[model samples]
Target chain A: MKAIEIDNLSKSYNKGKVQALSSVSFEVERGELFGLIGPDGAGKTTLFRLLTTLLSPDAGRATVDGYDIVKEYHAIRSRVGYMPGRFSLYPDLSVEENLQFFAALFGVNVEESYDLIAPIYKQIEPFRTRRAGKLSGGMKQKLALSCALIHRPSILFLDEPTTGVDAVSRSEFWDMLAGLKERGITILVSTPYMDEASRCDRIALCNEGRILGIDTPHDIVRGFDNRLYGISAKNMFTLLERARAMEGVVECYPFGQRHHLVADDSFSVEQFTRQLSDIEGLEIASAEPTIEDMFIKLMKR
Target chain B: MNSEIVISVRELTKRFGDFTAVDRISFDVHRGEIFGFLGANGAGKTTAMRMLCGLSYPTAGSGSVAGFDVMREGEKIKRHIGYMSQRFSLYNDLTVWENMRLFAGIYGLNRRETEERASALLKRLNFEAERDTLVGSLPLGWKQKLSFAIATIHRPEVVFLDEPTGGVDPVTRRQFWELIYEAASEGTTIFVTTHYMDEAEYCSRVSIMVDGEVRALDTPARLKQQFAAESMDEVFRTLARGAQRGE
Candidate 1:
């Protein structure tokens, strides 16, 4: 079953000065962990806003759980859970109070929905008395997740769920989402982190208010048709400039401490290393291309 | 405990009207090191950072930044450090190179240094061809990259980046941090705030902020060990729960 569907979706703000989304379309299957990968102003949030019925599209339409996004807005709201990127919860309320309030607002009692959030809520249960604003980033994220899941909506929309937390919190949050998915919840998450693309079941690499490409993470990386090499040296900057200028080199951008150089022509590691070594203080080694590489190459075309 | 520390705060506090935005917090940033400041929303990360950056004054206690007393030398600190906000702060009307030149003038860089550094920075960002391209015409990631380059063009002693990689793609983020590393190598201390956990792993040391307090400060690996987490994300969740330490 298609959990969510968007068709001919277009939206704009400021009397057309801002084209937030444009003729976008896609479908997410049941129980799929679909990711909308893009940077700021790529219409990811705009799409989320439209899907959640927070805003109406100037053109196009969408559906959540077989209900029209516009006509059945209230029904859709109750049937789907959403966690916006920002911490929008009331800071004055305690952790438990926030959870209870959200539960009541959704017309669900904590006792009935407790099982769904057992894992995450358990960790934060002790901090139940702490004010929502006083809790840590990771804790607030968990609290928000639990609140979103309290009603057990079949579809979930998480807009940049891991944006501002520590690395550990980010990982744990994904884990909780995975667990939620296993319980038959279809997940649609948007993130700016390309490395996070692989964790999704399928991804749509988006930019400039358009969807560039949509495919499985493995397929995206496999689509990178070039020999990638990592090079470093005493004079990394000078070596980078020279490598970028090398013959048959397509792209030479710094990756971590090493320069991830993509060859325009297929070249052996030895030849690549030798070509780099000719530049004083240059060092090189074979390397693999990441999702970011695939996204940039696809964007170029 | 070293007197050479670039930043030292003793029981610093901040309030807005009736709300205590930053609770009493204390931490010292070294003279030359990449210090990662992280927190969830409303965790007092922004308030704490504002106090350190001289954008907001503390309500209580005192501190020092870069040898100048933070309480009385806020102006001196601003001249010696570059700040890049999470949102783009550059002039959209100006070209990429023009923005750099404008910021260069703000730092009092001579015409020669401004021109030379603008060219160098644009080249490093792979936007040399777009030197004349209006900042508004560029993508968010590109704008963010250029902002960082321009911020550091003045070659300040420190750079304060508040959520620099918030909405940027991973590839852009990787390049952004490289520039930061280059600046650090040149002996410029980096006091960066971010929500991206992986970025925390790259910092020489990280401090997790919550409720206006420094909850955790250490190497990523050490925090991982302390939290029994295999990755930075797990470490963050574990600590974020304020889970009692087994030891």
Candidate 2:
């Protein structure tokens, strides 16, 4: 059976003034690692809430682990773990106390769930006596993940779990998730960072309350139809403007310290170089499209 | 390039009893440069920034911002600098124009000057249509950009951005960096803290703090070469591997 199945899901807020999600459809196979990639206000959080049974959808249907989201919310809730984008742990309680509290809510003891959380819990175990509020950003996230996994759910829903942590912590967090996936837990995560999308088995690129594209990260980049080139100069701002004004330039935007330019059929590297020869310190080369490039193109479309 | 040193520190230290949140860190930030401060969540980055921004007193060591001693001239440093964070400090209940006027007033701008600057800023950001709209209704990216503009409204010599691009989209992030570059070009020093490694690459220099100490500091390219890594992400991992805070 599929881990998750959604057909034409729709939701809105403020008496329909804001359409948070509009007829979205997607499915996740059992034991698959899926990602919901998008920017803020793209309805990623709404979708997570709906799937986790915290909020009801306005239209359509979804099933988590063969349990209907609305009618069988109790079953769905028992079978899935959720970590909200914002930190929700009690500040006054110690790290250990928070974990014990969450486990108790699920009618389970920390000892019974210790094996599932061992890899993560061990890291924060040294600070078990410290107040949850006193823990650092990375430590807090690790603690939160431990709480989520205490019940050993069949699937996990993590909403932007690495949004504010440092690069090392982010890498470590993903590693933990990958380890959990190895034990056969289906995972669905959402993030605004495009680079994180590549870490998932498959991802749905979302924007403006809609799913623009859904595929593996490799397949998504492979789908870009235009030839891309990386161009740089002494003055990036000037280079961006000039590249945008050039003929046969389909799209151009700043990427890091360089400008990523997409070209039309008539474009050639030599011709482009000759066109901008007057500008000093110019360098251009062919480049591969990243998830960010594809997202920009999809948004424009 | 003979750039002026806007900020300098020597063995900066902050201690809360025995915790030692910031441990003798040292660095320098030059005028018209984007200096990135990176660290693990509890690695003492916030503590260090607090000392430099004059929000908290250091237990030991010394530092100066905008040529003013951090120990005795915090108020002066505050006046010469602007700050923006992930959670912007704008009044959401107020209109865009009202927010601008309020901030300008706080910075001691006269009424006529406030109106002129607010109008010009709105036009420059293509936000004229939304001047009367409530800040709460604007998109996240738009609101962040507006917060940045307001932070620099006084035209301070330096600005501190605390994860300013958090949760923003890639396209909007690039746009935000354009604003950063524009400000730097006009001689505003940019001191930023971020978790995004790619963003670190855009900085003129970056310092990685691990366990309340600066583990590495250099330009992105030089750091990458020194660490023998392909990207900033790997370089960060190599430096932060020995951290004691997070297992």
Candidate 3:
């Protein structure tokens, strides 16, 4: 059975001045890890909110575990775990208390759900007496996840769960989510980080409330038809300017220290480098394209 | 990497009632380098930055930012350092130039100096044309770039960016980092926090915080090698588990 199914889902805010979601429709296979990838104002959060039934959609419909999103809102809330982008685990309660409260809210006890959160709980267990407000961003995130999972929901909706987290904490957080996937819970996570998209089983590229593309990370990159050349110079700004100025350079944008340049029909990497080397105080090198590169290309297209 | 340390922190701790937001952490931020300070949302990084910036007093610790003691000379530290918080800290009613001017006035920059600095920053950030655009009217990415510009209005020795690239697009983030690099090249120290591991790669060095403590601090390359991870994301995960194991 499909874990999630949404058809022509559309939502807006500010009296329709802001269209939060426009015909966002997709399906999450049972036990699959799905990512909603986009930048700010890209409707990622809105979509997540709608899926969780925090906000009613202006048009269309969605279902979690085949339960109607609007009519079965209460049922959906119980069957699905949602950790919002912000840290909302009760601030006054201790780590354990917050988890217990959430478990109770779902008509379960911490003992009944403790196994689900054991790996993460152990880290913050020592600080179980510590107030949620006092916990670190990473800890709060973990706590939120634990609360979401207390009910052993059929599906999980994590809205940018790894955002605003340390690199190490983010790494651990994804691992935890990956572990959760083993139990066959469909996970729908949205993140602003393009790199995180690859870790998902599949991803929907969103921009300005529109679904730009949806496919597995590898498939999306494979679909990119452009020839990519990565180039770097002593000065990034000058290199960018030169690439933009270069003949037949389709897209010249900085990826890191180096810049990735997509070529037109006539543009060649060797020839492009040869011309770029003539520029003073520049270091040019070839590079591989990442998911960020793919998104840049898609956005441009 | 320098003889003169821009910031020297020792045994930094912050407590709200019984909670330890920052638990006796310490680190040194050198001059003229991009330093990445990373943590989760409530990891106390913001609290620590606030303490270092003199906006919040550390419950206990001894630190000097830009040669001014955080405890004794907090006002002086504020004057010598700039901070861009995670939230859009600028006034929405103000124009880009107006925000810059307001910050300049607070930082004690002269009118001519403020104009020269604001114009230069705006030009570098490619928002010179949008200088008159109301900050509220601008997009999320533009506002982020503008906030960074205003934070450093006084040309402080060290600038703190609390997740400066939180929700902006990749293209704008790249542009913002260019500004940071330029500032670093010109002898300014950048202390930034970000969730994007790719952004962490650009820093000369990065430190990961877990539960109000520095879990790992080193160059991104070194951390990656030590963790035996292909990317920063894995490095973070491996270290988080290690921290969990250690505890």
Candidate 4:
């Protein structure tokens, strides 16, 4: 059975001045890791809020584990876990207290659900006595995840869980999420970082409150139709402008120190090299398309 | 390229009672160079930046920024440097032009100069239409761009960006880096801290802090080579896997 389903979901704020979600629809299969990938203000948070029953959608319908979102919110609430983008745990409370409080609210004891949260909780267990406010960003996120899982929900919604975290912490967080998926939990995560999208089982590319595309990370990158070339020179800024103005160049944008240039059918590496031969320290080579490149192309389309 | 050292530090230390937030860290930032400060959460990166920016006093050791002593010349240091934090620091209620005018005033620019510079900056950023719009209403990317512009309005010798690209998209991030590059090209030294490993590759040199100490410091290529890693992310993981803090 599907873990969750949405049909014609729509929402607006500021008296319809902002169309937060525009008739969005998608499905997450049972035990799948689903990712909502987009930039900020792309309706990611609104969609999560709607699924978690925190906000009512203006139109359309959605169901969590076969329960209608609006009419059966109470029942849905007990079956799912949610970690908001912003840190929401009580600052004055110690890490242990926050976990206990969340467990009690769910009518469960920490010992009763200890096994479910052990992998994540163990990382922050050493700092259990520390106040939630004093914990670091990565530790705070781990604590929040543990609290959310203390009740052993079958489904989890994490909104930008790895944002503003160091590279090491981010990889560790993903490893924890993957472990959770192994226990047959349906997970829905949202992030602005394109690299994280590859870690998900499937991703929905969102923009301006709409899903631009939905597919596996590999499939999304494979969908890019243009030949891309990575080009660089002594002065990268000048190289970007020059490449953008060149003929047969469809799109050009900086990716790290190099510029990624998309070419048309008439484009050739030889012609491109000859065009900028005067430039010193020039380097050009064919490059593979990444998820970020695909997202930019989709947004432009 | 200016080989002059814009920021120099030696054995910089900061302590809160018995807790050592920063312990004997030292580094140098060169003029027109992008220096990245990286670390795990609660790894003393912020504490060290606070000391260098003169926002917090060191418990021991010494440092200098913009040729002024960090110990007794914080005011002089502030006047020669720009800083943009993770949070947008502009007044939300103020219009774009108003915020620009306010910052220009804070930087001691004359009324006529403020008006001219603000207009020119808005035009250059293609934000002329947002001149009268409240800064709160603009998108996150625009707000960040404007914040960077505001931070450097006085043309300080060096600019400190503390995770300035947090929550922004890849496209916008690339554009933001263009601004950083532009500033650096004009001889404005950039000392930045970021959590994004990919961003670390863009820096001329990077320092990774762990548990109040410098664990690794080198160019992105050299660090990756030294660690036998493919990317900065791997290098960081290899080093930070032994982090003493945050368990």
The sequence of per-residue lDDT tens digits that candidate 2 reaches over residues B165-242 is 988888898889889988887889999998778888888899999999999999887999999998888888888888
Best by TM-score: 4
Candidate 1, residue A16: Cα displacement in angstroms equals 3.2
> Residue B37: error of model 2 in Å?
1.8
Give the Å error, residue B50, model 2. Answer: 1.4
Candidate order, lDDT descending: 2, 4, 3, 1
Per-residue lDDT over B44-143 for candidate 1, one digit per residue giving the tens place of the 0 to 100 score? 8777887787777788988987777777778888888889998889999988877887889988999998888888887778888999999988878788
What tens-digit string does per-residue lDDT give for candidate 2 at A3-115?
A: 99999999999999999999999999999999999999899999999999999999999999999999999999989999999999999999999999999999999999899
User: Residue B31 of candidate 4: its Cα lDDT?
Assistant: 96
Q: After superposition, how far is residue A222 of candidate 3 from its true place, in Å?
A: 0.7
What lDDT tens digits, residue by residue, belong to model 3 across residues A6-67?
Answer: 99999988899888889988899999999988898999888888888888999999988988
Residue lDDT tens for model 4, A89-134: 9999999999999999999999998988998899789989999999
TM-score ranking, best first: 4, 2, 3, 1
Residue B150 miss distance in model 4 (angstroms): 0.5
Q: Give the interface RMSD values of the models in order.
A: 5.5, 2.1, 3.6, 1.9
Chain A TM-score of prediction number 1: 0.94
Who is ahead in TM-score, 2 or 4? 4
On lDDT, the stronger of 1 and 2 is: 2
Candidate 2 — what's its lDDT?
Answer: 0.90
lDDT of 4 by residue, B118-202 (tens): 9888987999988999999888899999999999988889999999998787778889998998889889999999877788878
Clashes of 1: 10
Interface C-alpha root-mean-square deviation of candidate 4: 1.9
- Can you give the lDDT of residue B186 in candidate 4? 85
Label model 3 with its docking quality class.
Answer: acceptable
